[model samples]
Target: MKLKKLSAQCLLALGSLLALGAAQAQERVTAAIPGVVNAGTPIEFIQDGFKGTEGPIAAPDGAVLFTENNNARIIRIAPDNTTSVFLDNTNGANALAYSPEGELVAVQTIEPRVGVILPQGNARTLAVKVDDSLGFGRPNDLVVDKKGFVYFTDSGANGAVKPDPTKTAAPAVYRISPEYVIERIAKDITRPNGITLSPDEKTLYVANTAGEHIYAFDIDAKGKVGPRREFAHLEGLRQTENGPSSGADGLVVDAEGRLYVASNTGIQVFSAKGEPLGTIALPKQPQNLAFGGPGKKYLYVVGRGAVYRIPTLTAGYAGRAK
Candidate 1:
């Protein structure tokens, strides 16, 4: 029945796109430097010599923000190609999203918690524990919609024992409404990790790190997740001198609705129909990416100790916001 429901949902989504027109449904982009993965396209290494980084979120003013997990700091890559610390003394700020009202919402990597930080640098705890009952193992990635609702993933077996195997609740995706109420969306996903929303705010794409797959969820008017569907499957590609297989990690969506996935090989682009489009080679294995700049044509990519940007065909969330 799950398979059938997903088939129906895909058809419905495709039909909705058709109703809108094909020109708006698909977008194509390539690296600015043809094939060389250089920093010419404002590919600035904001800070170097860090353990790792991920979850690049684009703010309103064409600034891109990402988490330096090893250093427990959130850094901003300015539009001028400079870098500065947005938040410090943060505990493993892994994935972050900007609310409709411009608040920075983050999934704490070290602690099993979600926090909301204001532009003035004030941080407030939102949801500390899952369901207000079970202790969280790790709260991984998050994304927010235009309606001020936040959707996040919790992989409950980070270091601790799997939480309740019989229930398949160890790895799950959740949604938090504007009123601050929380609800579990999907609990059976294998290692739900990186997450983002479609440009139309109708679909949710989640990456399962261990499972090596990206899953999709249809979000309804009430913010309810319909069912689980496979968005993309990652096979272990040829390993580079840098690290592991092209295991998929973080995800971001463009104004044209294409999904940009951070993988070991580089950045993988996929259409809304789950078709493999192309790959953007990186100097190093990128951990995450975001679109920024004046027209949202710049792609900001993050690696271990560096960040880079290239020109893309589609504008980013920042440009789209306007």
Candidate 2:
């Protein structure tokens, strides 16, 4: 039944492109994978040696902002390729996004906080303990829905992140609404890490780093999550340093509904229906990525203390928001 529903939706999405005209759907990009990134495009080095970068989001001015997680700062790469410090003492801005109102929201976990970057480049903690709850376990990655609600993952079991029978519960996805009300939507993923919503805004996707699988959930109008189902799996990963299979870390979906997953090997691209599309290998496994440039034509990748840029044929979902 799940496969049938997904197959119908996949065909519907293709028909949506057809209704929009082949030009708008970018039929030329089909030369690559059916719906992933453009193949044969050379990925160029933009900068390197940052403090283990993540959250390479693009600023409105076309500059890119990524967190130097180790150094606890946000670095900006200008359009001219020059790098400089953007914000200091970020509290550990791991993954970032922009609100429709132009505020910068972050998963600042060093202090175990979810906050916003103020206009003057200061940090403001929004929710520290979800209204006196058990406090955030380890807020890893997050995404902001079109309505400014944030969905983040809190992998319950920390400490080397290895699977153990002693672990009581799986990681969970929390929904922080536009009004700042926090709620736990799902809690079955083991070590959920990266997260993003579908292009149609009807589904939410999450990467379970410990489970080595990616899951999807139907999202309602009120930011509530429905049933969870398997979306994709991280393939060909050898055992990690900690006696476990490599898992999906960060994730993003393109306007064409292609899911880009960050894993130990590289960025794994999958179609809307959970079929393997292709892989874009990096020098080192990327931690996260964001699409930017005019019309969202470029992908800015960051990981292993470096950043890379490559042109893309499809626009990114909500990537151009202020």
The C-alpha TM-scores of every prediction are 0.77, 0.81
Indicate the residue-level lDDT of 19 in model 2: 68
| lDDT tens per residue, model 2, 75-194 | 988876788999898777787888777889888766566888756565567676754455665677888767788888876646333333243334678888878888877876667888
Could you tell me which residue pairs clash in candidate 1?
43-309
- Across 165-206, the per-residue lDDT of candidate 1 in tens digits comes to 443336678888888888888888766777888887888998
Count backbone overlaps in model 1. Answer: 1
The clash count of every prediction, one per candidate, is 1, 0
Top of the candidates by TM-score:
2
Taken over the whole model, the C-alpha lDDT of each candidate is: 0.72, 0.75
Best by lDDT: 2
Residue 137 displacement (Å), model 2: 2.6
lDDT, candidate 1, at 260 = 79
